[model samples]
Target: MFDLFKEKLADAEQTVAFGSRLSGACESPVCIYLHGDLGAGKTTLTRGFIQGLGHKGNVKSPTYTLVEPYELADWQVYHFDLYRLGDPEELEFMGIRDYFSDTSHCLVEWPERGEGVLPPPDIDLTLSYAGEQRVIELQANTEAGLRVLNKL
Candidate 1:
């Protein structure tokens, strides 16, 4: 079953807090796609998620590097930014399949850029500017995603 959730974030802090809440709900290996325009707080939310998962350091966008690996105590998280991609086939050269292992959690930004090369995301999250604030909408496309949604 598919499920969806929507909320308005008053500021960047709220966006981060929301991501932390989402981290608490995620228990198994899952893929999440983040959609937003530049400065829409996608990386801010990811920072909260990485920190929420117990990382104590920085959470920088992988814009230039393409992907950043975070080895947390219990979860292997990979944050990917495909915005700079010129070809989806480049994902093959990088062994994209290995990142989706049963024990890893993957968060992808600009997923459309990697289209056919990437795995289908369990959760699709979209953020948009709303006046001075922001709006977020999350959709669960699989059972795993639905489980997370139910927990949230």
Candidate 2:
């Protein structure tokens, strides 16, 4: 079955809080694909997720860098933004395969840009503008994702 969850966030803070909740339910070795337009709070959600997973420093989008690595006590989190990717082939050169490990959590923004190069997402999260607020819909594509949704 496809496990699903939806929420309407009143503001950026609420969106972040929702992301934090998701972070709490996630286990390592999960790939999450974030789909949203510009200024849709993808990075904000990522900030909350990383913080909730026990990171203390500032969380920034990996827009230019492509990927940012966070080494936590028990998990290695990789935040990837493929918005600027000129070609999906660039991923191979960056050693993208090395980032998604059995002990890591990967949150990718603009995953469609990577297309065939990106790993299949366990959970696919779509954020959309709902007037001045935002609506987030999460869909589980794998068993691991279903478990996470159940926890949520």
Candidate 3:
């Protein structure tokens, strides 16, 4: 029931602001996949999103650790950067299902690297460079995603 939603971000701040807006639409127990090239503002967007959800501290990419967990007042957020993943099986070994509980929110970057190991995303977010700015697109693939889009 959701169509495409697109926006142009004039700079990093705008990207973050857009993310803050998106956070308002995000509910718990959902997975979001982020697609973008290096330095394309993926982490920046996520920072705004987490912060917008009332996280007071820093929100950085888990480039080395692969995953970062944040405990907010009402929800658990897990940010995953699988760029350095040596094998998708590592996810199963780590009990990935435990991290994606009914009360958790997952934002995954480089999801292609996870392939069959990762769960399908409810929302697919793509960020691309447009001249000196960036363009963002959001697409919904599930009923939960459609609800998030409605909130948007």
Please give the RMSD to the true structure for each candidate, in Å.
0.8, 0.9, 1.2
C-alpha TM-score for every candidate: 0.98, 0.97, 0.96
Model 1: worst 10 consecutive residues (lDDT sum):
1-10
Runs of candidate 3 with Cα error greater than 4 angstroms are: none
Query: After TM-score superposition, what is the CA distance of residue 38 in candidate 3 from its true location, in Å?
Result: 0.5
Off by over 4 Å in 1: none
lDDT of 2 by residue, 1-152 (tens): 48799989999999889878989998657899999999999999999898998899999999999999999988899999999999999999999999999889999999999999998999999999999999999999999999998898
Which of 2 and 3 is the better model by TM-score?
2
Query: Best candidate, lDDT-wise?
Result: 1
Give me the overall lDDT of model 2: 0.92
Cα lDDT for residue 141, candidate 2: 96
Candidate 3 lDDT, 56-108, residue by residue in tens: 99898899999999998888889999999999999999888788888888999
Please report, in order, the local distance difference test score of every candidate based on alpha carbons: 0.94, 0.92, 0.89
Candidate that beats the other on lDDT, 1 or 2, i.e. the better one? 1
